[model samples]
Target: MGMKASYVVQPFELHRKRLRPARQEAAQSESGALKKAENLAKRMPGAAALRIVADDETGELESATILEAFGEVPDDFAESLQGG
Candidate 1:
């Protein structure tokens, strides 16, 4: 088994006074994810850069981290990312 790391940009939208996730995008690197999230935040309610680590063979999540958050992100964004 091997561990794999991934970077992703998640954009958020406000709906009925709630922050909801929009389409998610994969990034080549952490910096790329951060840049993408920052750009998306301009036109979105919020955006976040995430780093996720998991087992490649089992597809089990090892951890999820919020690298950065832009604009009006959810108050429980970090907890949500951790599947809490």
Candidate 2:
């Protein structure tokens, strides 16, 4: 084999056997994230209550007094954390 050909296959062929576990782990992590998304979607339709807590007056967090539909998350979800 030529020098370039041998070098090209070195890392790939060497790591071929190790790819399975790494791929499996990535797949498992993706599956878990998908499951969480599905669960949240399922709970969305019945989300009738939300508690907004603003600990600082300087914070721009605001609470919603009306919802046109269910599962409506406030835009200030992350802003609410700024108070702390």
Candidate 3:
């Protein structure tokens, strides 16, 4: 099977002041993706968190947090780092 590669960024959303995860975005680079997330956070006054995620088709993934008002990460984020 062919390998897949992509960079992603997601911003946390706030509804009624509740923290929640938002949709994911595909980006050209890690910095570019984080920039997008940052912009999203700026546009969203309620944005609670942000993460830059990178993944390969092989199920390998990595993530970093830019804003952690809540200091939280994805549930499966650690699993992604395990050898596939």
lDDT of 3 by residue, 1-84 (tens): 344544566555656766556776667865566566666766654222334444545554464544433233445543443532
Top of the candidates by TM-score: 1
Query: What would the per-residue lDDT of candidate 1 be over residues 1-84, giving only the tens digit for each residue?
Result: 999999999999999999999999999999999999999999999999999899999989999899999999999889877773
**Local distance difference test, each candidate:** 0.93, 0.26, 0.51
TM-score of 3: 0.49
* CA deviation > 4 Å runs, candidate 1: none
In terms of lDDT, which candidate is stronger, 1 or 2?
Answer: 1
List the candidates' TM-scores in order: 0.94, 0.24, 0.49
For model 1, give the 10-residue run with minimal summed lDDT.
Answer: 75-84
What's model 2's TM-score?
A: 0.24
Report the alpha-carbon TM-score of model 1 versus the true structure: 0.94
For model 3, what is the error of residue 39's alpha carbon versus the real structure, in angstroms, after optimal superposition? 0.9
Pitting candidate 1 against candidate 3, the one with the higher TM-score is 1
* Number of clashing pairs per prediction, in order: 0, 0, 0
RMSD of 2: 22.7
